[model samples]
Target: MLLTDTHTHLYYETDDVKRAELVQRCKYNNIGRLFLPNVDAASVAMVYSLESSFPDLCYPMLGLHPCSVKENWEAELAAIKQAIHQHEIFAIGEIGIDLYWDKTFLAEQLQAFKQQIAWAKSLKLPIVIHCRDAFDEVYDVLLQEKGDDLRGIFHCFSGTVEQANKITDLGFYLGIGGVVTYKNAGLDKVVAQVSLNHLVLETDSPYLAPAPYRGKPNESSYLIYIAQKVAELHQTDLETVANITTENSKRIFGV
Candidate 1:
């Protein structure tokens, strides 16, 4: 069964150069595609480098992460725009309101988020959201700003069923990651009720590792455990889980 990790940061500047080998491991484990997202101006080069090195296997996204929002948000946004123009990005992603970490730039984050959304809309591209602890606010933005032009995935979706319904209503898909395999993840209930059409597999690697490897750094190879857990939760077979999630991924990413 083939799986796709729709969210992952395999090209961290501080990360070791073992990422290429990690990609090999993911291929060995059937996690064939990698969707790489940029955090800010600093990450554009790295995001492109990895995508350039593995064009057929790895895809890149141009977006400013919520955590990277700050006083110089305009400059950062300009840089993100530059990346979009400089490379063929897969989507405008890892972009959304994240109030959990710091609210100092919440206002700026909101503005930047909307700007990116409009930019993506103008380009006729889908977005990949990174919503963390600001579901209501994020949902509000989608409702207010999306307006049929916006469509994408909610990365690392660990929300209530009501939230899932709302997001998909906006023509988006949920990015279920290794978090679903955790003991107290609470995603089993979510996936049990949500249809396979609304779900897509992701590892969010170098983060949110699954149950068997919960404490370890995540990688695409661990997506099989996530797919298994999802299949079991949805009362279906592994192949069905892999196939549908992959199709959902392809639909959202246009790949």
Candidate 2:
């Protein structure tokens, strides 16, 4: 069975030995494919380095993260756009509106989000969104840009079923991550109701680790736990979950 982690920042590890170990663990767990999304211009090299090291296993994406939107966002976006043209990326993301930490850059975030969406459309590539506490704001922008080319994954989705429906209806898939395995995250209930066709698996490593590894540093290898939880929620087996979600990833990344 081949499991796909549609969203992961495993490149953040930096340590060659530790990074290799993480990749080995993922392979051992049948997690064969991993898509890497760089948050900003500074992270582009890291993402490309990981993909270069494991060219067959890792796919790269470029974008400016909402959290990274600051006073110098215009320059950062220009640098990221230049990097995007230099490489063949699978998607343009881990981009969207984030209102969890601070709302000071709400206007900037909206502008950056819309600009990235246009980039994705122009390139005919899928996007991987990173929506936090700004679902309504993000969804509003998405609605404004709705089209055949406006499609991607809603990364690290921890929203309600209604939100899930809204995303799927727009031809985007819900990126199910470690939160689905949490006991009280309520994402499990939402996953149980959403069809597997509209769902994709992710770890968002170094961030939201699945249970047992929760509150600790996460890695791509832990994707198996999230997949297993999804399998249980969907009343299916691990292989089925792996097959479906991995196929869904292929559809989104086109790799």
Candidate 3:
């Protein structure tokens, strides 16, 4: 079965030993494609280098993460614009409102999110959003900027059925990750409610590892566990889950 880890931070590991092990395991599990997202200007080199090292196996997206928004957000966005022109970014992503950790930069986060959304539409590239405890705020911007050309994945979705429907209505895909495996996550019910056609699989590795490894660091190879959970939730086989989500990944990333 073919699998696509649409969101992973393979570059987060600077240790060669761990990196090599993770890469090998992903290969063994048939995770053919991995998408790396840029966090900020500081992460640009690492993300690009990872994709450069594994051009065939990995893809990269350029954007300022909501959590990374700070005082000098304009400078960061400027750097992103320059990089977008210089690099072959698969998407403009890992961008959205993240009000969970710090609310001090709420204004900056909102501005950055809207600016990045404009960039995605201007570049005609898909976006990967990172919404956390700010679905309504994110939806407000998406609504204000709504257009036929705007599209992307709602990375690490943890919303209700109504929110899921609103997302699909905007031509966005729900990025289902390890959260669905949690007994009380209720993400399984969300998954069961949404069709496979609108779902995509992700690991968000080095974080949010599925059950059996819930509290531990996540890795791309562990995507198999998330896939198995999705299969069970959909009342289907693993290969079916793999095939459908793989196609959804390809459809969005065009990779």
| lDDT (Cα atoms) of all candidates against the true structure | 0.87, 0.93, 0.92
What does candidate 1 score in Cα RMSD to the true structure? 1.4
RMSD of each: 1.4, 0.7, 0.9
Predicted candidate 2 versus true structure: per-residue lDDT over 1-255, tens digit per residue: 899999999999999999999999999999999999999899999999999999989999999999999999999999999999998999999899889899999999999999999999999999889888999998999889999888899999999999999999999999999999899889999999999999999999999899999999999999999999989988999999999988888888888
Candidate 1: worst-modelled 10 consecutive residues by lDDT: 11-20
Error of 1 at 121 (Å): 0.3
Give the number of the best model, judged by TM-score.
Answer: 2
What would the per-residue lDDT of candidate 1 be over residues 1-255, giving only the tens digit for each residue?
788888888776344468767878888888888898888898889888887777888899889999999888899999789768877877998899998989888889999999999998999889989999999989998988866678999988999999999988888999998878777768888888999999988888788899899888887788899899999998999999989999898888788
Q: Rank the candidates by TM-score, best first.
A: 2, 3, 1
**Worst ten-residue run, lDDT, model 2?**
246-255
